[model samples]
Target: MIDLRSDTVTRPSAEMRRVMFEAPVGDDVWGDDPSVTHLEHYLAERTGKAAALFLPSGTQSNLVALLSHCQRGDEYLVDQQAHTYRLEGGGAAVLGGIQPQPLDGLNTGELPLAKLKAAIKPVDPHFARTRLLTLENTFHGQVLDADHVAQTTALAREQGLATHLDGARIGNAAAASGSSLEALCAPFDTVSICCSKGLGAPMGSVLVGPEAFIATATRWRKVVGGGLRQVGSMAAACEYALDHHLPQLIQDHEKAERLAAGLAAIDGITVTAQATNMVFVAFEDSAFAPEPLHAWLAEQGILVGALYAPRFVTHRDVSMADIDQVVAAFRDYFQRLTR
Candidate 1:
């Protein structure tokens, strides 16, 4: 099946697998794993953070950051639709006793600084203490404006609120924006970056922040079962992706543009948004039922979300030829529907 479901589904390349096979391993719980140590150091330096920790997944990475940043009853403000707040199974609330104040955000996933300022609870005992303001880059494949982020982080700092960034797709953001990785991560106090996403690693996420904060996150990681032994295999794959596949993300973004352009010409479909390896298409008419189109595409081995404005993701495994085939399948489906 042509899995446009998510970038997370991409398998590791042979070169990455070779590196994993030859990887040097050690006990990470004792802080001696060479591969994990190398990955953490590389991510920290690249993001300009004082330190970094390798976690099993993005969910754990974000959870550790949340646990480190906020205490029990302390609230972290986040976009209502962001992965950290809406997804991640409410780990912060359930496991850490940290509350998330989910707030309205723009389609680009930017929370208004004014709204954020207003949301910060006054020291009154009646409200949960607002401890952190979290933001997501490449929110639904839409990159947040750098100026907006700079201003928001500055405001948060002035208000004595710590800032965290859930940058599960920061490489995509960097690729699309022509910004350095460090430049993208410079504003926030903590960032959770996923290698398993568009980077094409089989699994791994690196959380970067201050040394003291990472120490705190390290403790949280252990409590949450992220302290794995001889995790070098996955760590090696992530490092391989960072070294080789990071630059190819532009091709993924370009293919998304191509897919969007092709889908826009279809009668019943509207390409609502396109950026950084993902396309969000909407049904032009409410009468245009999605089930038939989905079924037809599925028969052709083309996969997409089962919704009106379904999202299509492009990744390392999807080529230009695959993009054309997907477009053709979409065109054929619409053509048959019109018949």
Candidate 2:
């Protein structure tokens, strides 16, 4: 089946597997795993950060970042729709006692500067002190504007707030905007780069930042049960992805553009948004219902994310031919409705 549900579904290639199999291993908690240590250092150098820590997942990376930045009673400002705020299971609040001040944001996934400035507590005992400002790049596959990021981070700095970036798909953002990873990540104090997404690693995310901040995140990671033993193989997979799969993100974006264009031409479909490997579409006209399209596509050996408003993701695992098959299936479904 051609899986368009998410980039996370991509499996490691034989070459990546071979690299993992040959990787040397040691206990990561003791900071002695060569593969894990190399992966962390590589990511840190690429992002121009002082240090990096490998974690099990992006959610843990973000949670550890928040824990490192904020104290028990402090809060962080984030967009309501951001994965760190909405989709990450409230780990920061549940585990770290951090409060989240979620604000409405633009369709671009940026929090309004005025609202952010207004949300900071005035050193009062009545409110949770806003300690950090968090943002997600490639928010729903859309790259955050560079200027917007600079301005937001500057605002946070001026307000005496630390900043963190949930850069799970920063590779896609960098590829789409022609920006270097260092340039893209420079504005934030800390960033979480997920290797399991479009990069095609089986699992892992590296959190990079200043040495002191990374020290704090490391402790938090251990406290949160992220201290894995002999994870050199998984770390090797992530390192391999950085070398081999990171460059392919551009092709994923191109495929999304083609898929969006194809679906937009169909009579009963509205192309809602397309960016950095993701294409979202809405079914138009009351004559056709989107509910059954899920099963229909499944029968055709195609898969998408949502049932009603579908989100089709293009990844290393999905070829251009698969994109054409998806477009043909949508065209056939709409044509049958009209007939």
Q: Which residue pairs in model 2 clash with each other?
A: none
The digit string of per-residue lDDT tens for model 2 on 1-339 reads: 999999999999999999999999999999989999999999999999999999999999999999999999999999989999889999999998999999999978788899989999999899998999999989999999999999999999999999999999999999999999999999999999999989999999999999999998888899999999999999999999988888889999999999999999999889999999999887777666666887899999998887666788999989899999999998998798779
Cα lDDT tens digits, model 1, 1-339, are 787888888888888889999999999999889999999999899899999999999999999999999999999999999999888999999998999998998868888878889999999999999999999988999898999999999999999999999999999998999999899999999999999888988889999999999999999999999999999888999989988888989999998999999999988888888888889988887787888778888898887776665999999888888999999998887887779
The per-model lDDT (C-alpha) reads 0.91, 0.93
Off by over 4 Å in 2: none
lDDT measured at residue 15 in model 1 versus the true structure, 0 to 100: 88
RMSD of 1: 1.0
Overlapping backbone residue pairs in candidate 2 total 0
Per-residue error (Å), model 2, residue 213: 1.3
Error of 2 at 125 (Å): 0.3
How far residue 234's Cα lies from its native spot in candidate 1, in Å, is 0.9
Task: List the lowest-lDDT window of 10 residues for candidate 2.
Answer: 282-291
